[model samples]
Target: MMKIDLQKEFNDYTQNLNKASKDQHINTAITRAVKAYRSTVAESLERFPHTPEMAAEVREIKTQAMANNSELLAQAMASVERNKGKAFYARDRQQALEIAAGIIGTGKTVVKGKSMLGEELHLREYLEEKGNEVWETDLGEFILQLKKDRPMHILSPAIHVPREQVAEIFSKFFNKDVPPEIAEEVGVVREFLREKYFSAHVGISGANVVAADTGAMVIIENEGNVRLASGAPPVHIVMVGIEKIVPTFQEAMKTAEVTWRYAQYGVPGYVNIVSGPSKTGDIEKVTTYGAHGPKEFYVIFVDNGRSEMAKDEKFSQALHCLRCGGCMYECPVFQVTAGHFGHTYLSGIGAVWTAFVSGGLEKAAPLVYTCLRCGRCMERCPMQINVPAMIGELRNRIVNGAAQGEEPLPQVAHS
Candidate 1:
C-alpha cells in the first residue's frame, strides 16, 4: 500500500481550494453534475413522495437497528449459515483483507462490483499482490482502476473526470482512438468487461443492507454490473460494514429505498437480493448448491472500529449514513474540490467517518475544519445526519487536544 499523510494532503487541498474551484474543467464538471443531480433528485423525491413521516420512521428503524447491533449481527450470521452460506466477522481492515484473501486464494481471476468497503481496505491491491488478477467491473471503478486513482465520489467514482478525459484514458487503455461520446465509451467498457464477467473465478461485492431475519443481503445499482459480477462467478464474497444490518427484510428494503431515493433515483434499475449460495430444488426433492449463479456465498461483516464508534452516540450517527451521494451535491466545498476534500469517505459525514473509521482526530481535523457549516447538507441528507454539529464536536475535541474517550488537554499558564 502507498503511504499517505492525510494531514499534509488535507492541508495542501485546503490551501488550493480556491484554485480548484476556479479551474475551468473542474468547475464545469462539478457545476453540471451537481445541477443535474439536484434537478433529478428534486424530481425523484417529488415523484417518490418521501414524507417527513417516512423519513422519521426510517430514522427510528435505523436507530433501533444500530442500537441492537450486536444482536442483529449474531442473528444475521446465524441466518446466513442457515441459508447454506458461510459468515465471518472481521474486526479490522487487516482481518477483513486476510479473510477475503484466504477465501479468494491466489493465482485466481476475480471480478469486483463497486464497493466502498473494499476500497477502504484497498482490496484490489492486496489481491494483486497475492498473485490474483482482479478487475473492477463497475464502469466508474474500472476507469479509476485503469487510471490508478482513488474514487472521486462514492457512488460515481470518476465523477470528476470529464468525458473528454475519459476518451483519452480509454484510447490509451484500448490501444486505439476511442470517441469522446458517452455511448461509445460505455460500449468500449461493456465489450471489455463482458469476457471478465464470465471468466472470473470469484466475484466481490458490498451490500446496501443485510437482513438479520432472513440473511438476505441487498445490493442496489443502476448498472447491471453488480448482478453479473456477483452472479457469474462460482464463488461470491460480500463484505459489508456491520452497521448496514437491519432487523428485518422489510426494514432492509425500506433502507435500500431511502438510500437510492436520496441518491437521485426514484428506483434503482436493479435490486439483487441474495440469501445464500445458489440452490436448486429442481432435482426431485434434493437441494443442491452451485446449480447456477455462485455455488458458494460468503458474507464478511466488517467491524473495523464500528463497534467502538457505536459506543459513542454522536459518532454512532455517522454509521446511520445510507451511503447516498446527495450531501456532496449540497456541499459547497465538495462542489469545488470534488473528492480531494475527503480521504476515504467524502464530504462532511465523511469527516466524522474518517475520524472514527479511517484514523483519528488528527487525520480528520483538516476535513472537519474545511466544512463550511452550511445547513444544506443536513437538509439534503436522507439520514438527516447533523454534519455541522458533529464537525463542531470533532473540532472541540481536537482543539482541546483530546482523543476519543480521553480527558481534554490541560490549559497552559499564560505569561
Candidate 2:
C-alpha cells in the first residue's frame, strides 16, 4: 500500500512483462488507469444520445477519406503549403526522425506537448540524444518525464502513479515541502510548467485533427499547456498521423467535440484548439507570420503503417479511435495489467495500434487475451467504436497463428 509509482509501474510493467507471469503490480497499473478513464467517460457518454448516429458519420468520414487516400493526402499537403507551413510525409519512422532532426537544427531547447505520436517516434529521447533540452508540458506526461518512463494511459500519462508516490516524486523534484495530496500535486505541476511554457525555444505537439480544407491543425487538451507549447515557442512542430486528416474545420469541430467528450468524461477540465501557431495579422492591416507566433511551423505526416491499417476490415477501426483512450479505462483486463495490455500503445486500442504500428501478431500475441471482453468501453465511445470487437479480430489472427512458431502467448489470467 505504498501507493503505486506510475512511473515505476510503467517501468515494472515493461521490465517484468516478458520475464515473469502476470503479477498484482502489473494488474494494479492496468486496472487503475482503466478505472479512472471508465468512471469519467461514462458521464460524458450520457450527455449525448446521438452517439450511434455520430459513429456512422465518423465511419463515413473515414470511408470517404480512405477510398481516396492519395487525394486526401494531396489536399492536406497542399493546404499546409498554402498556409506558409512545411509538411513532410514520412514513409516510416526513420524518415520521420530524419525530417525532425534536420528541421530542429542544434542547441535549441524544446518544450513538447503530450503527443503519443512523438512517443512513437521517441522524439524526446532523440532530441535528448542530440543534446537538446526537452520538457514535457502535460501534467501526467511531465511527471513521467521526470521519472523517465513511458506513458501508461494515453490521455493521462501518469495514471499508473498513486497520489502518495506522486507526492514523493514531486517533493523530491521541487525540493519544497510538497503536500501529500493529489490536488496539491496537480497544482504544483501547473506552477512548475509555467516557466517551461515561456522559456521554450521550440514546441512539439501531436494533432488530434488536421483540417484538409484550411490546412489547420486542431489540438484538443483538457489543460491549456498545448496552447502554450505551440503559442510560446518561436518554432512549433506537430507530429501527426496521416489518418488525422478531416475534410474541413466544421467537420474537425464536430469530431473535436466528440473527442473532448470522450476524454473529459463529463466536461473536460479544459479544452484548447490551435490554428496554425498563434498568428496576429491585425497590426498595420498587414499579416505577420512570427508576430507573437511561431516563425516556422512543421507538420510531419507519419505513415508508419497507418496506410496498412486503412485496408483491413476489422483492424481499420483502430484508426477511427479519435485518441479517446476510453477503451483502456473500460477494459477490465487493462485495469490490472496496465500497459501489459499494450506495446507503446497500451490497453485494447493499443493492442490494435501496436499490431499495426509497432509489432504484429507475433509481438502482440501475449496481449490478445488480456481483455475481459466487456463492452463498457464501446458503450461509452462517442463514435461507439467496437474496441472489444477489434481485439477479437486480433485474437483470431493469433489463434490462427502467424509466422510459424513466432512464440505463442503465455497462459495469462483471462482467456
Candidate 3:
C-alpha cells in the first residue's frame, strides 16, 4: 500500500488545483464533457417524462430500505442462498478483500467489470499481489488501468484522457503503430480484451442495486463488456456496498432507471439481472446449474463505515447516492479542478462521503472547503442530497471538534 501523508496530500491537491485551473487542454476537455453531459441529461429527461415521479418513489423506497438495513441484508442473504448462491457480509475493506481473494483463489486469471467498490477495496492490486492476473474489462477502466491512473470522473473514468493521449497509450501498450482516431482506438481495445474475456477463469463485478426479495443483482452499463465478463467465466464474484439493497425487484428496477436517467442515458444499453448461477431444465425434467453462463455465484456486501454513517441522520443521506454522477457536472468547483478537488469520491457529494467513509475531517478537510455552497449540486442530485448543508456541518465539526470527549483530529486545510 502507498503511504499516505495527510499534509502532503492537502498541499499537492492545492497545487494540482492551481495547475488545473491554468491548463487549457484539461479545462477545455472538462468543459466540453460537462456541457455535453448536461445536454444529454436534458434530452433524456424530456423523453422520460415520468422520471420525477419515479425518482420520488425510489427515494422513499431507498429510505425505507435503508431504515431496515440489517433486516434487508439478512433477507438478501437468505434469498441468495435459496437461489443456490453463496453470500458473505464484509465488515471492512480488509475482510472484503479476503472474501474476494478466497473466491478467486491464487494463480487464476480474472476479468472484472467496472466497480467503484472494487476501487474502494483496491481489489485488483490485492489480487495481483496474491498471484492472480486481474484485467479490468470496461473500456474506460481498461484505459485507466493501462495508464496507471485513478478515475477523474465516476461515469467517465478516463474523462481526463483526451483522444490523443489514449492513442499514444494504446500504441505503447500494444507495441505497434496505432491511429489517433477514436474508432480505431476502440477497435484496438476490443480486439485485445475479447481474448481475455473468454480465457479468464473468474469474473468480478459490483451491483447497481440488489433485490432483497429475489436476491437479484441489477447492473446497468452502456458497453457489452460487463455481460461478457460476468457470464463467460465459470466463477462469478460480486462486491457491493450494503446500501445498494432495495426492498423488491420492482423498486430495484425503478432505482436502476433513475440511475441511468441522471447518468445521461434515456435507457442504458444493457440492464443485466442475475439471480444466481445459470440454470437450465431441458432434459429429464431436472434443473442443472452451469448451463451456459457462470456456474458459481458469490456476493460480498461491504459495510466499511456505512453502518456508522447510517447511524447519523444528517450524514446517512450519503448512502442514498445512486452514483449517477450528475452533481459533479453541475458543480462549479469540480468543473474547473476536475478530480483534483476530490479525495476517494469526487465533487461536493464526495466531500461528505470522504468525511465519513474514507476517513474523518482529515481526509475531507481539503476538498470540503473547496465547496462554494452554491446549492447547484443539490439541484442536479437525483437523490436531492443537500451537499452544501453537509459541507457546512462537516466544517462545523472540524472547527468545533466532535462532542465532549472525542479526539480532535481534523487536519487544517491550506489555502
lDDT of 2 by residue, 1-415 (tens): 1232235534554565543235644456656555565666565567676755766677678667666676777898888888888888999988998898888877878889898888888888888888788889888888888887778778877767766777888889999878888788889888877887788788989988888888878887767888888888899988899988888877777777777776754555545555564566697867677888788888889999988888765556678778877666666666555555677887667777888887666555556656556777676565566667777667765555433224344323222
Q: List the residue pairs that clash in candidate 3.
A: none
Q: How far is candidate 1 from the true structure (C-alpha RMSD, Å)?
A: 4.3
Q: How much lDDT does each candidate structure score?
A: 0.87, 0.74, 0.88
Total clashing pairs for each candidate: 0, 9, 0
Q: Which pairs of residues collide in candidate 2?
A: 6-160, 6-161, 27-336, 30-334, 30-335, 30-338, 31-335, 31-336, 34-329
| lDDT score for residue 117 of model 1 | 90
Q: Model 3 — which ten-residue stretch has the worst lDDT?
A: 406-415
lDDT of 3 by residue, 1-415 (tens): 3334567867877898899778776688889998899899899888889998899888898899889999999999999999999999999999999998988889999999998888878889999999999999888899999999888888888888888899999999999988889999999989998999889999999999999999999999988988999999998898899999998999999999999999987888999998899989999969999989999999999998899888887678889999999998988888887887777688888988887777667889888888998889888888888777778778777666655234344322210
Cα deviation at 46, candidate 2, in Å, is 3.8
lDDT-superior candidate, 2 or 3: 3
Candidate 2 weakest lDDT stretch, 10 residues = 406-415
Question: Who is ahead in TM-score, 2 or 3?
Answer: 3
Q: lDDT of model 3 at residue 249?
A: 96
Task: List, residue by residue over 1-415, the lDDT tens digit for candidate 1.
Answer: 3344566866676676667677777778888989989888888778877645567788998899989999999999999999999999999999999999999999999999999898888899999999999999889999999998889789988887888999999999999999999999999999999999899999999999999999999999988999999999999999999999999999888888888888876778999999999889996979999988999999999999899989986568778898988899889889988887787888898888888888667778888889988768888887788787778778888666555666353312110
- The residue pairs found clashing in candidate 1 are none
lDDT of 3 at 341: 73
Higher-lDDT candidate among 1 and 2? 1
